[model samples]
Target chain A: MQVVVPFAAETPKTRLRSVLSAAERSRFARAMLADVLEALARTGHDLTVVATSPLSSDDDLVGVPSTVRVEVDDRPLTDAVDARLPRRGRTGEPVAVVMADLALATPESLEGLFGPDADVVIAPGRGGGTNALVVRHPDFRADYHGASYLDHRAAANGVGASLETIDSFRLGTDIDEPADLVEVLIHGTGRSPECLRALGFELERTDGRVDTERSLDSTSADSRSR
Target chain B: MQVVVPFAAETPKTRLRSVLSAAERSRFARAMLADVLEALARTGHDLTVVATSPLSSDDDLVGVPSTVRVEVDDRPLTDAVDARLPRRGRTGEPVAVVMADLALATPESLEGLFGPDADVVIAPGRGGGTNALVVRHPDFRADYHGASYLDHRAAANGVGASLETIDSFRLGTDIDEPADLVEVLIHGTGRSPECLRALGFELERTDGRVDTERSLDSTSADSRSR
Candidate 1:
């Protein structure tokens, strides 16, 4: 089975702006790519990272391992992944379409999803969303990660493939905000070794100007309100 | 206030059998020490690491930052920490005595234990044991880290020191057995960065292969049995 991680290298979209800072967005993109590659290596699966950003002279994706191929496109995210799937000879093999942003994806969950006899598998995110999808056949048609669980279910039903859903906390957590980083730090994302290494990625400021205690209390209160 | 952490450079007499495997012992010791230091650093507290082994070596304490002074003693764990406290000039300030084995200790919880007023603070561990102790004065002593939360409370009563117990998951998890490593891997220790990086630190092979699913099932069965 081949793993296909579809990611928008640069999220110029306004919706993402509210969720991620400039540094966080870039780190999120890189971390996702790194995590996908690391997961593949751990699971001993063939993997490809597909991005929708045009290749730049100093692109961060330049020195990735030889086994892991990168495909750059000036198209939408889904289109880029859809185009690359055929070129990689994914017709007969099971292909897992994973989002780069989920920091908590683990090898056990990936292996469970790829188990034999499962024709289609979907991992649902916390907010009734989907973070991962796996299909045994290449012909399965679905817009990746848009109403993902519903779309994939519909696609699986249309194809008459047996569908399975793996509910996992590891697969549910996708880092998108500063608060999300706090959660990741508290409860680790299994694949976030590099992201965790980045210095100054802490909830409390060193100089104590932020009044971190009050800030945390307010954030908790806000979350409860929501 | 100064933070004092007590660690045994050599395994205690009771722990000798468990520490027979040199590699395992090395990894375990390093993990425990590293976690304590990292938690102290994260909490923004000045710390001194006191090793209770008579045969302590510089090699055993390598990679620890220069700011962290190491004190070697032939006495018991509690006494070693007590001896180090006075020399650091923390007589007037409150001092927190932390166990080197509790990887979940966080900065917030540590600081919260001393909020507004200095008191004798106790954090109990999962196995009905104490893992953390904060004292306003060095003279305020209680038998530390035993099956004696109430004993420590009684001792505090004898001294007329204000006693406060801070309940936190981060302060409760102390690595004592093979099963504890699984908790460290899943939930992560506050100081996991260095411990996880040490040589021969394989999460899968630790303690004769930790089957988390089996353990969970057994726990459920035990609960039903109870």
Candidate 2:
């Protein structure tokens, strides 16, 4: 089985711009990518990172294992992954596409996406996004758009593919919003959380839910470093 | 400075009957209640457990500290808690009401509910249920019916009480359904997970999500023991 991780290297995670600066967003994106890659690597799967632009430096790929392949695609996510997906009955091999920002993803959580029970396995995010997927049938291609999970289900049905939806909290939780960073602090076990903590992000309870708060002392030092 | 934990001892967790037997549900509910009580006791609050009926035996109170007081109140939840709520300007003491099924509650998570910023602090459950709350105003009382979190907000507004909502995953997560058992196994720190594991519950990936599966060996043995 081969796994492809789609990363937005250029202007990544704009939703988190309110909380993370450009440099911090870049670093955090890479950190989440590293976490995803680590989980995929542990699964002993053939890993390929399809980034929108070239990784800036070795720092951008710090925790990613050397065995994994990194490809600079520059194209949109749907197009990049669609081109790589093998058609059903062509190669008859399973292909998985895992988002780079699944900060809470673990090998155990990723195991569900690799099972051969279905020709298409989709892991839906909290707000109707397709976080991760496995395509066993070559007929099914990627469709990354607004409410992509619904579109993917339609596509799979259109292709007559046997589809299964994974309801995993870890795989479904992508690091996009400032509120999501709290989940990383609570349940994460990788460099993504380390990066957040190093940037002084801490969990605080407010507004009837848990949210992240950066330390004031670290905020000043972080600005100085930047 | 006072905390009330409401419990339904007679027919606890009827929603979980599909997965857990009567005996198992009773044991699991007690385990979750114990977890909540442990977290509350750690906060050093004046703890009162308002049960619908008397506790079966000392076994039902295992893992709960002796400092906590148990009271028998065979009324509906809303009526039971409302009866205990101190009216504004009377005692002028803050009172907290925490659900007995908050298997994920911790001292840290409960801290947010006790903050003095608001006259009423509510921690809404995942599905708009009021999981826990603190009342500093004498006029405000609980209404634990449908969408009680929203109703509590309205009730607080009706009384012109300054309200704050504590956004805590730990406090918000209440163990009710069989599917909720997976969360206890994942992030729980108390005897609830132990109780589940002892019943041979284990996490397994299926249909793209992690779910609990009780072992066949344990199932037969559990039935035999019952």
Q: Return the top candidate by DockQ.
A: 2
Instruction: Tell me which residue pairs clash in candidate 1.
Output: none
True contacts kept of 2: 0.00
Model 2 segments more than 4 A misplaced:
A1-226, B220-226
lDDT for B16 (candidate 2): 76
lDDT of each: 0.56, 0.80
* Candidates, DockQ: 0.02, 0.03
List, residue by residue over A18-56, the lDDT tens digit for candidate 1.
434455556546755666566656888777777676534
Residue B133, model 1: lDDT of 81
Q: Which is the leading candidate under TM-score?
A: 2
> What is the alpha-carbon interface RMSD for each candidate?
17.0, 11.7
Give per-residue lDDT, candidate 2, residue B119. 88
